[model samples]
Target: MDANQQVPSEAALLGLLQQFTLETERYVEAISNRHHLHRTDLNALAAMVAAAREGKTMTPGALRAALNLSSPATTALVDRLDRAGHLERRRSEKDRRQVHLEMTDSARATGSELFSPLAGAIAPVIDALSPEELHIVMTFMQGVIEATMTARKDAALAEPMRPLPGT
Candidate 1:
């Protein structure tokens, strides 16, 4: 910031973060609707893709835990994606009993189709950032994510929701 500029207030910063989250959620919902995928399915695919980018294998159990889903629900999700040609189940060569999931070409194409426009829109802003600015932004994002995860864990341990009087 320049000498004449004031730092953003915490409320203003949080508001901006909220707006960014809302817009991102809207974008993801639009993609899910257009692709005829449930949000969970899209989330599952995203988890798998992130794992692949990290050079880690995604197994059914791992996915279930990542998504906090029941085994049967995860199995059903895998089957649905498999039938849609979006993913493949491969037996681990080192352990035939273990199964790993791989995103198929179709899934990659769909993901590109879904996100390319958003990436194009955001690329210029990201490109304009200096390395130092980029590092700060990355660190800020990581901090935000960690805080969000901590909040989620806290919420999970809070009192469970109960039905309203009428419902």
Candidate 2:
């Protein structure tokens, strides 16, 4: 993007994105291991925490869908996290049948302690971005997220590939 640099091709840009995703996954896996938590557990916690920040409640059903988990699997996950004191299940006052998911104080503290270093490293890069650049990056990232969701859904509906015989 610099004056002396050529604009990257779409393939090059996609390669960069893929690299970024892999690196992020590595970081998440490392943190999850250190905290004695499964990667899926961390993902569920992250979803709930983001929902809380947006003033939206996360329900068990919603969490299941967000994580693409089966009902039984979700129930097991909830039970495990609850037992670990990292998650709370609150019955909705308006609907006794509805159960909302929330992160416990311990979970929040663990998340903060684990991710603060990454945030500190990235904050300066974000801070240096101009408003226009930030907006563009946000829009681009959102579009990529939506595209990934669509691709996932499509892949889910497709027939599974089988290995060729007589290799």
Candidate with top lDDT is: 1
What TM-score, computed on C-alpha atoms, does each candidate reach? 0.89, 0.88
**How many Å off is the CA of 86 in candidate 2?**
1.1
Candidate 1 TM-score, C-alpha based: 0.89
How many steric overlaps are in each model, in order? 0, 0
lDDT of 1 by residue, 65-104 (tens): 8899999999999999999999999999999999999999
**CA lDDT of 28 in candidate 1?**
96
RMSD of 1: 2.5
In model 2, where is the ten-residue run with the lowest total lDDT? 1-10
Residue 19, model 1: lDDT of: 99
lDDT per residue for candidate 2 within 44-161, as digits (tens), equals 9998988988999999898999899999999999999999999889999999899988899999898899899899999999999999999999999999999998999999999988
